[model samples]
Target: PPPPPPPPPPPPPPPPICQDVGYKVYRLVPKPSVQDKGGDTLELELPSPRSSILDTLTNMLCATCKPLDTPIECLIEDALYKADGEIYVLGRISEDDLIPFRSHKINLDGWADLHLQDFLNLGFHDKNKKDNLIVVY
Candidate 1:
């Protein structure tokens, strides 16, 4: 019998390097704490606090080895309903807020919002576990 023909060579791998440019939405979940409303009747803190998440994300991006755009947005507790412990932090916002944060274009929407409780449910582990700013990114 004759030998079979050789198979075709495999395709070359993709480019060695490429710029990393993209947008990411993160949900900031706070760490656990003993402080709670004296009773169920008491009001609970909003899911993802706007100010807190904004601060944390700003710091994280700044500290990142590969720094990205600036002037990011913070959409905390946008949802109308209550979602257990998982908050949803959306990168998309309304057109109004989008203008000012043009520097950080990553923030898709001008009106973005997030829920703190919902964020925690995403399983964001923190060392201190004290109202952690959970970033879903």
Candidate 2:
């Protein structure tokens, strides 16, 4: 008989830190006249819900994936969320301890809950929340 196969290595441990999910929307914006380009210039639009570091990643990825008019179809590089303008990505709104979300891992359920409104709020609010503190008079 073949020597006993080594016990399957314990499943690789899960990541130490749970990464947060990031989302972005791509809009068709014309390039500035001042800038000279052969074809088109992919402009990076600020994501809503107050642009965060994570959101910027998505914007940059979509913008960089030029040649292709739409960047949403491109493979996700690093970490980012892609969506068409004015469309809210769908996901359930529920309270669960182990709910599936994507940042490092793609979770359909979590992605569904994302709404365009989330991106629309960008720049309107400070993500760092430093300004959120109310000063009591």
| Highest TM-score against the true fold, candidate | 1
Q: List candidate 2 stretches off by more than 4 Å.
A: 1-50, 66-137
Model 2 lDDT tens row, 54-79: 34434333333322244353233322
Cα lDDT of model 1 by residue, 1-137, tens digit: 98998999999998877555675566666854445566755554434334544454443443333244444332434321112222223453334533332222121111244444433343343445543343333
What lDDT does each candidate get?
0.39, 0.33
Off by over 4 Å in 1: 1-31, 41-58, 62-64, 67-95, 99-137
Q: How many residue pairs of model 1 clash at the backbone?
A: 26
Where does candidate 2 clash, by residue pair? 48-119, 48-122, 49-121, 49-122, 50-122, 88-116, 90-112, 90-113, 91-112, 91-113
Worst 10 residues of 2 by lDDT: 97-106
Error (Å) of candidate 2 at residue 2 is 37
lDDT of 1 at 4: 97
Question: Candidate 1: worst 10 consecutive residues by lDDT?
Answer: 79-88
- Residue 54 of candidate 1: its Cα lDDT? 45
